[model samples]
Target: MRRAIAGLLGAGLVVGALAGCAPAASDRPLVVVTTNILGDVVGELVGDQVEVMTLMRPDADPHSFEISAQEEARLRTADLLVSNGLGLEEGLQQHVDAAAAEGVPTVEAGDLITPLAYADGDAEGLDDPHLWTDPTRMVDVVAGLTDSLETALGDELDAGELAASSAAYTAELRALDAEMASAFAAIPEAQRALVTNHHVFGYLAARYDVAVIGAVVPSGTTLAAPSASDLDDLVSAIDRTGVRAIFADSSQPDRLAQVLADEAGVDVAVVDLFTESLSEPGEGAETYLQMMRTNTERIATGLSP
Candidate 1:
């Protein structure tokens, strides 16, 4: 009986010691990412170095996707909060702000890159928040994000490994950029005009020298409804520009674009693009790289004039 009691006491002490050595809630560093694009980028960069808690899911609209109160609490507890600033996350701004108010280090990926403004429509001069449309800009975002992660994570992150991972990812972005450039080069200059559902492709048009003739909604965000005048103007522009294909965001209803296409009386092919969100597995775009590649291929095929 004495020997059994001694062994039990020893095991209890060992368990206590193990419990004492475990990391606390605050000590266990976490990264909360807002948009899935940035979430995926951060995941690729951090890679098990720290926990990445992504708030938004695949195929969800960033402009209008809201988080629950629990997610807001998680945001506040993060060691670092990474978001695509420039007001891209319009719906989740308050939650992100709540986290920042609690002293969480925030990295606005949009602010890190060279921000571009809307080239046309009512949103002109407003900073275009769709920087990820251009992979070169995403490369810049990736570099800035790496620095931000290192600064926020400090010694918790392995610098050498992070650098290597970042370099590899940046290389992939560059490669994708080159491939896109080569593909867009095939588009005859006359067929390089874009007329999408909204003003989401400014960076892409700017990057590839494609003309932004018009958008059905006449604004940057999908929430904006198109006025009759706006639709009329777009129809005129589509007819005038000889726009063979009109790209609609898959996440949004194609009803507006269809209306424009039918009213314009043009043989415009309304192609669907995963502009603001990623799709589920077995779908065309599941990752950031895959999304970009798929968009490029679809754009090429749709507007091959």
Candidate 2:
């Protein structure tokens, strides 16, 4: 009995040693993405081939969301770190930079597209990081992202499958762009002006040939507070432009937009749009494509004469 017990103990020790030697990051390649929107896009592109860890939660503001220490450690170890650059991920830039410094492959979606400048507001002349607002621009981003992912994860992932998936998604984005153009074209030209909670729709406006009169907050980031003069100026523009609605981000409180609507003294409707982040499941903007489609329909309906 003593000999048998010793043999079992030796076997147990070997099993424990083997368990300790197991890979910490699992068998699949890990991709750590900063924003939920980019996370969704990467998931769509990669499917189930790799593990994708998204930092931001649904409906969370990209400008102010944070991550825990565990997440930061995982980010540094990611095979690829994807982010929306041009200062969109304000709170997480330091973490992204640290991950890049550690030699993790990094891809910024904004860096992939043709960026548009803020035509007005506190962010005037600065590159607008909201590239996904225009599906055409997003196609450019998706193409670049495909190349980056192929280069970074090709050894672990099937390059042919990755290219096929990207091509399929790119075709869908082109269809969405066409759909948006048709919808917006139906609205009268005089009503083609947009007033949002902030400078969130510059890319969209530029894409669909609409004018962005102004924003209630007068800035690109929602973290910035609107000054009294900013609101006053936007209200005047709303009155002058005769815009039918004020588009506000659904994730953000619409109180400022409501106040601007009331101050404008017009029968302006406050339309809630998924401007920054995707919504929770069944919340009507769960996916990036769904968010854009819903916003397109709402914007077309709101502006139609």
Candidate 3:
């Protein structure tokens, strides 16, 4: 009778252990993305395969946006963490490090793309992390992310479906590249100069054959401040380049751009572009493709003869 009771107790223990090990809500593999642009791309690539949570806001500053405590905790549950490394996510590095220390697999998109250097002047030859400004470079990002998702979450996601989604999204990015080429070609050769709020347009200018005059903030990262001489130098460059317009980020304050334009003493138009971040839904630059297209149109119009 004691042996029979012991056997029953052993069976109950096995049942309880199996029940405890059953899937819970948190069992769903989560992907914690650092920036909204990457979030949008990952969403397109993975579709409904894995749960994706982006830490940054749609229009937040990538160089300085911080995640909340709850969001940091969410990082703990993530199977994969995708970030814009190479000093882009300046304010969120500590959290990313913490998450990685906690055993979350991390992928930095900047490592995948051939990063451009800050053209001339300050921080010249420093690796610029703003690869999204060039849609073709984003092709590399998409390819790397596809492989990363597979490596990180293949057990939880369907391999075939993920590949299909990634391929389709990459095709869309290529179409965006072709569209940008056509749009920028319409601008006169002499009028292809760019003066932005900051030095965030290196990749875009490099890819499209546009000459970057100079920037208000003359550095690759936005965290750096411009001095009085810096502003004066940019104004002189703007006047010399005969740049019709100075572009500023839609998400950032454009007072500096306006100041520089005013300082230039030319009829420089201050235009806004979705340069650094994506916009909210129903807005002009809500998606990555939409952001690139919208910027291309604005740039073409701004620099047109």
- When sorted by TM-score, best at the front, the candidate numbers are 2, 1, 3
Q: Which sections of candidate 1 miss by over 4 Å?
A: 1-28
On the 0 to 100 scale, the lDDT of residue 193 in model 1 is 87
Clashes of 2: 0
For residues 182-289, write the lDDT of model 1, one tens digit per residue.
Answer: 999999989988889899999998889888898888888888888888988888888888888899998888998888889999899999999998888879888999
Q: Clashes in model 1: which pairs?
A: none
Residues 12-112 of candidate 2: C-alpha lDDT, one tens digit per residue: 99999999998775789999999888899999999999999999999999999999999999999899999999999999999999889989999998888
Q: Which candidate is the best by lDDT?
A: 2
Query: Would you list the clashing residue pairs of candidate 3?
Result: none
What's the ranking of the predictions by lDDT, best on top?
Answer: 2, 1, 3
Task: Provide the lDDT at 231 for model 3.
Answer: 85
The candidate that wins on TM-score is 2
TM-score of 1: 0.91
Per-residue CA lDDT of model 3 for 1-305, tens digit only, reads 99999999999999999999988775568999999999999999888778899998988999999877899898987889999898889899999988899889999999998788776657888889888988888889989998998999878988899889988988998888889888888899899998887888888888888898888888876788999998888877877788999999998899988988887898999999998899999889899888988899999999998
TM-score for each predicted model, relative to the true structure: 0.91, 0.94, 0.90
Predicted structure 3: lDDT: 0.88
